[model samples]
Structure formats: structure tokens, C-alpha cells
Target: MSETRTRVADHIKHSPGVHFNELVRALDLAPGQVQHHVRRLLSDETVRRAEFYGRTHYFPPEFDAWERGTLALVRRETARDILGHLLEHGDARPDDVADDIGVARSTLEWHLDHLVERDVVRKERDLHNRVTLVLTHPERTTRLLDDVSPSLPERFVDRFDRLLDHLVEG
Candidate 1:
């Protein structure tokens, strides 16, 4: 799998239903560039889109395995990274996470939502309208064995570095 495709898939797996602009920020690609790959992914049936309010969210298919195709190479590493972050931080809000990790807010939320849906992470909204996140129940035995693994730790690290670089570059 090409690194860009893998990165896009990983981004989708982490944060499903993400918009093109958010994807551009998360993966550090241009808007048109991200849209191009997203269009291909949609055509390939590797991704599906949904509408929430006025926004469209792109997510992996319900029974479609992420382990196949371009994503297989980095799934384990990604899961390890996500899991490590949850274990270390306990819980966090999506926006805070995006800021901390250097990915766009919507992008981080996509990942958080995916983690929640896949049983890798749990999510709850508070009275103040803040979404709290934590690792899912019956924690993953290992990153490799999940029926589906949305590796979070590696993503955390990768985006964190990117965030740092973004800061430095600016």
C-alpha cells in the first residue's frame, strides 16, 4: 500500500466520518489532494460516508476488514500507539486530543469515534457537552488480535511529532 493511502486509511480508521478539510490537517495533505484519495477510497468501497448535521463523515464499512489492503502493514503499530495513549492518559476530550496530537479536531474526533465503535475505546458526553474518552472494556489482549484494531498509540506519537514540527515550522 502506498504510504498516503495507508495514512488516509489509518486516519479514517482512527477517526471515521471525517471531512476533507480535517483529513487535510490530520494527514498534512492539501485539501484537493486529500479529496482525491478520499474519492478513490469511496469508489473502492473501502470507505463509506454518513451525514451528521450538515457535514459528511467517512468511515470504514461495518463488516469490511481493515486488515486487508493498504492498511494491513501498519494496523498493529497504530493500535499499539492508541492503546498506549489511553492507558497513559486515562481519558481525554476529542478537541484537546487534536490539539495535543497536532491533528485537526474533526480528525481526532473521527479516530475517537472509531475507537469507541470498535470496542477499543469508550466514550461519554458530560453535562457541559464535553466528550470524555477512555479505553474500551475488556482491554485488548494485544494490538494484533482484535477482531478489528484501530491502533491509537502510534497515531498519537506520529501526530504529536507532527504537531511539534508544525509549531517549529511556523
Candidate 2:
């Protein structure tokens, strides 16, 4: 691989769940340049990708489907906060989780939809049908938690979502 291609590969290797725009920005490369290198990397199987919602996250070849999904969500600040809260506190009521995370219920629900769909989190119901959010793989999720740090754009997007939720709620 060329130096540029290697750099892209290394970035994706180190940052398992980095999305496209973030990758371009992080590497200080033009979008076209990044796209060309990424295409080469994908063709050679040096790295892999997962598309979650509207974003396409790149990963090294080692991460399985579950880890790919989990990492994709983990790259989002709100979703990461939710997972971190649950990881530290165990399963709890959805309302309590929203309150504890200081996010609107709708925001929490939005992140929860992705988390639950990814199987990184599960919602359990008691006999009364009350819901509790539980991590599907506590130990693994805890380890993967350190694998990603949300970038400025990623954080901004998540915060924007929260702001919109607040607007709608009010």
C-alpha cells in the first residue's frame, strides 16, 4: 500500500468505528483523496465498513458483526453516554436513565433504538410491563468503550439531536 493508503488503514485500525467525513477531516485529506484510498483499502480487504442509520463507519477486518454494530453506535456521544451510564449502573428504568444521562426522553429513546437494534443493549419487561435497559455484553462492551472517542463533528451532531429533542419536548 502507498503511504497515504497505509495512513488511512492505520487510522481505521486505531479508530475502529470512524465514519467517512470524520475520517477525511481527521486525516486532513480531501474528500476525493480519502474516498480513493478507502476504495483501495476496501478492495484489498485491509479494512471493512458498517453502515448504521445514515453513517458509514470503517473498521479493521477483525471486528465481527456485533462489535461493528456496537462500535458504530458507540461513536455517537449520546449513545456512548447511555452505554457508559448503563455499564456503570446496571439495568434501570428508561425514565431514570434519561434523567441520569441528562438527555430528553425522546433523545434517549432515539439512541436506545439504535443500541437495542444493534444488540448492544436489550430492554427487559417485568410482570407489570415496566422496562429496564440492560447491556447484552457488559464485559465486552466495557472493553470496547475505550476503543472510540467521538470527534467534534460527531459530538456536534449528537448534541444537535439533543437540542432538537429539547425543542420538540418544550
Candidate 3:
């Protein structure tokens, strides 16, 4: 592998679930340059890609489906905050989680939907029909959180993507 491809692979190895733009910004490389190197790395099987929640995330070849899915969701700040809040509090009502994370209810619901779909979170209703959110795999999610901390720019991109998704869906 070329030095550039190796560097790109190394970055993805350390920062699992990093998206293309994040890679460009973090490596301070031109977008086209990063794309070229990333393509080469992918062809060489030095990394793998996962598409979830409207983002194409790259991971090291060793990551399993669960890890890839978890890492992809946690790379977004809102989702990570929700997971952290749930882990800290065990289980919480939707309103409580929205309040604790300081996000609007709709935004909270958006992230919650992704989490629930990934099976990292579970939603249960009491007899009274109140919804409660629980972290289905707290220990695993916590461990993966250590590996997928998004930078400020990545967080901005994630929020922007969510906003676009909301507007389009509406």
C-alpha cells in the first residue's frame, strides 16, 4: 500500500466509524485526495464501510456488525448523549431523556429511533401506556463509546444531516 493509503487506513483503524468528510478534515487532506486514498484502502480490504442513518462510516476490518452499527450511531453527539444518559440513569421516560440531554423532543425522538432500530436501545410501555427508554446493551455500548468520539466538525455534520433528514421527511 502507498503511504497515503496506509495513513488513511491507520486513521480509520484508530477512529472507527469516521465518515469521509471527517477523514478529510482530520487528516488536513484535500477531499479528492482523501477519496482516492480511501478507495484504494477499501479495495485492499484494509477497512470496511457501513451505511447507517444516512452516513457512510468506515471501520477497521476486525469490527463486527454490532460494533459497526453501535459505532456509527455513537459517532453522532445527540445519539451518544442519549446513550450516556440512559446508561447513567438505567431507564428514563422520553421527556426525561429529552430534558436531560437538553435536546428538543423531536430531536430526541430522531436519535432514539436510530438507537432502537440498532437494538442498542429498547422502548417499553407501561400499563398506563407511558413510554420508557432502556439501554439494551449498556456494557457493550459503553465500551464502544470509548472508540467513537466525534470531533466538533463531525458533530456539526451529523446535526446538519439530521436537520436535512427531518426537513425532507416532513
Candidate 4:
């Protein structure tokens, strides 16, 4: 795929509900140019768009190993950090999570919010007024990872291993 299409695909995979304007901003492409490529991507079925907040939001199609596919579109380094932290202890505060992931608080919050919005993770408020994170279903964690953006069933484990290594090395 062209770099632009890959960027669009990755953006949609990570932020399933992202709009054209946001895509334009994210990719630093003009609105018309972004729209053109997005339309092509949609036609190819490599990406999809959905209605959200009264505008069109893009996403990847449901496939076998969705989570790994979805993570591929995300900032891999950021995702590596976030997933590593979650898989280790299952949850943490947004602040601690930021530290764990080596991201700014706002960036971590962005990723967390996106994850929560996608139902890939759950959020809770604790007694100390701190935000707590948890994977909604432990049993489905593997499945969730598998289904995030769709991948071949055989590649799930291998991809996950690489994802882990990506995080660890970061």
C-alpha cells in the first residue's frame, strides 16, 4: 500500500471513529486529497467509515486477528508501552500509566480514551479519586487482541510476541 493509504488504514484501525478533518490533520494532507485516498481505501475494503458525532468516522473491517491488526495502525511504540503495562498488572492509574508507557499524560489519556471507546478496555474510578484501568474481560483479551483489526489466525501469536518486544525495547 502507498504510505498515505497505510497511514489512513492505521489511523482508522487505531481510532475507529476518526473523521475526515481529523484524518487531514493527522496526516497533514489537504482535505480533498485525504478524502480522495480515504474513498479509495473504502472501495478497496481495506478500511471502512462509520457514523459518529454526526460525521463519518473510519475503521477497519472485522477480521480474524482484529486486535493485532488494530494495534498495527496505532503508534506502535505508544501501543507497546500501553499494552505491556496492561498485560503485566491488568490495570493502573492514568498517571502511572503515562509513566509506564513513556507518554505525556495527555497522550496516554488519548490512547486510553480511544481504547475505552472501542470497548477494548474498561475504566474505573477508585476510592482515592484516581482512575483505574482494567481489561473488561480477561478471557476475551486474546480474542480482543485478535479481533482489533483482523489478522490471520496463525499470525496472532507471532504478532503479539513482536508487539511485546516492541514495547519492551522502547
Candidate 5:
């Protein structure tokens, strides 16, 4: 493999769920250059791609479906914040998570849906049927969060979601 491809592979191996834009920024490579190398890497099976929540995240071949999904979701700041909050608080109500994370309830629900769907989070109901959010795999999620960092696009998406929530709520 070329030096650039090796660098890209090593990055994905270390980072696991890094998106394209994040890879470009972290490696300080041009977008087109990264895209080119990524394509070659994919063709060569040096890295695998997982698409979730409108972002294409690259991972090493060793990551399973659950790891890929969890890593991908945690790449979004709000989702990571939610996971971290749940990890710290044990189990929490939807409103509490939204308030603690400073995101609108709608935004939190959107992320929660993804998390729940992927089995990363579990949503239960109380006697009154009030919703409670809990991390289904807190330790694993926390460990993966250490390896998965948000990309620039993921950050922008999170900000845009918050902005939309503000505008809608207002």
C-alpha cells in the first residue's frame, strides 16, 4: 500500500467510525485526495463503510454490526452527549435528557429513536407509561466512544438539528 493509503487505513483502524470529512481534517489531507484514497481502500477491502443518519462512516473490517452502528451514532455530538448522560445518570426521562443536553425534546427524540432502533439504548415505560431512557450496553458504548470521535460534518449536522429545533420551538 502507498503511504497515503496506509495513513488512511491506520486512522480508520484507530478511530473506527470516522467520517470522510473528519478523516480529511484529522489527516490534514485535501478532500479530493482523501476521497480518492478512500475509494481505493474500499475497493481493496482495507476499510469498510457504514451509512447511518445521512453520514458515511468508515470502519476497520473487524468491527461488527453493533459496533459499527454504535460508533456511527456516537459520532454525532448530541447522540454522544445523550449516551454520556445516560451512562452517568443510569436511567433518565426524555425531558431530563433534553434539558441536561440542552437540546430540544424533538431533537432528543430523533436521536433516541436511532439509538433505540440500533439497540444501543433501551426505552422503557413506567406505571404511568412515562418514557425512561437507558443505555442497553453502557460499558461497551462508553468504551467505543473513546475510539469514535465526531467528524466535522457530524458536528455541523448536530448544530443544524439544534438550530432547527430552536426555530421550530420558537
Candidate 6:
């Protein structure tokens, strides 16, 4: 493999769920260059791709389906915050989690939708049918959580979504 390709592969291996644009920016390579290398990486199965909640994330073939999904969610600031909050607090009411995170309820629900659908979280209801967010695999989720730190672009996108959610709520 060429040095550029090696850089791309190693970045994906280390970051594990970095989105395409972020990868390009992080490596300071042109889009076409990154695309060519990433295509080859994907072709040889040196890397894998997973799409969850409208974002396509790249992995180093070491992550399973669940890990890929989990990584995808955790790569975003809002989703990571929600997961971290639930991890620390145990099962919590949806409103409380939203309030604690200081995100609009709709924004929290948006992330929770993917988080719940991906099995990172489960919405359990009491006899009165009140919803509480519970982590499906707390230990595994915590381990994954500790490993991921979102890129600046990822955090910007998440903050933008929160802004939109607040605007809509208003």
C-alpha cells in the first residue's frame, strides 16, 4: 500500500467510525485522493462501511455490526452525551435526560430513536406506560464510550441539529 493509503487505513483503524468528510479533512487530503484510497480500502475489505441514521461511517473491519452501529451513534456529540448520561444515571425518564443534557426534547428523541433502534438503548415502560431510557449493554457501551471522541466537524453538525431543534420547539 502507498503511504497515502496507509495513512487513510490507519486513520480509519484508529478512529473507527469516522465519517468520510471528516476523514478527508483530518488527513488534509483532497476529496478525490481520499476517495480513491478509501475505495481501494473498501474493495480489499481492509476497511468496512456502515450506514446508520443517515451517516456513512468507516471502520477497520474489526468492528461487528453492533459495534459499528454503536460507534456511529457515539461519534456524534449529542448521541454520545445521551449515552454517557444514561450510563451514569442508570435508566432515566426521557424528559429528565433531555433536560439534563440541555438539548431540546425533540433533539434528544432524534438521537434516542437511532440509539434505541440500534440496541444501544432500550425504552422501557412501567405499568403506567411512562418511558425510561435504558442501556442494553451497559458495560460494553461504557467501553465503547470511553474509546470515541467526536471530530470537530461531527460536533459542529450535532450542535447545528440541536440549534434547529430549539428553533423548531420555539
Clashes of each: 13, 0, 0, 11, 0, 0
lDDT of each: 0.58, 0.90, 0.86, 0.62, 0.89, 0.89
- How much is 78 displaced in model 1, in angstroms? 5.9
Question: Model 4, poorest ten-residue lDDT window?
Answer: 146-155
lDDT value for model 1: 0.58
Q: Give lDDT tens digits, candidate 1, residues 24-104.
A: 777889877788888888889888876533546677885233322112322334334455566667787665555555555
> Residue 132 in model 5: shift from native, Å?
1.0
Q: Which residue segments of model 6 deviate by more than 4 Å?
A: 168-170
Clashes of 6: 0
**Model 5 regions lying over 4 Å from their true place:** 28-33
lDDT of 6 by residue, 49-126 (tens): 988667788998878999988988888899888988988889999999988999998898888889988999999999
Each candidate's root-mean-square deviation in Å? 10.7, 1.2, 3.6, 10.6, 2.1, 1.5
Q: Please, what are the lDDT tens digits per residue for candidate 5 over residues 69-99?
A: 9988887899999998998999999999889
Give the C-alpha lDDT of model 6.
0.89
Q: In model 1, how many backbone clashes occur?
A: 13
The top-ranked prediction according to TM-score is 2
Superior candidate under lDDT, 2 versus 6? 2
Q: What ranges in model 2 sit over 4 Å off?
A: none
- Best candidate, lDDT: 2
Q: For model 5, which pairs clash?
A: none
What is the lDDT for 97 in model 3?
85
Over 1-170, each residue of candidate 3 has an lDDT whose tens digit, in order, gives 77877889889999998988889988989999998988878888888998986878899999999889989888788888888888888899999987777666778887788888889999999999999998888898999998878788768877886677557655
The estimated TM-scores of all candidates read: 0.38, 0.95, 0.85, 0.44, 0.86, 0.92
Q: Which 10 successive residues of model 1 have the least lDDT summed?
A: 65-74
| Per-residue error (Å), model 5, residue 13 | 1.5
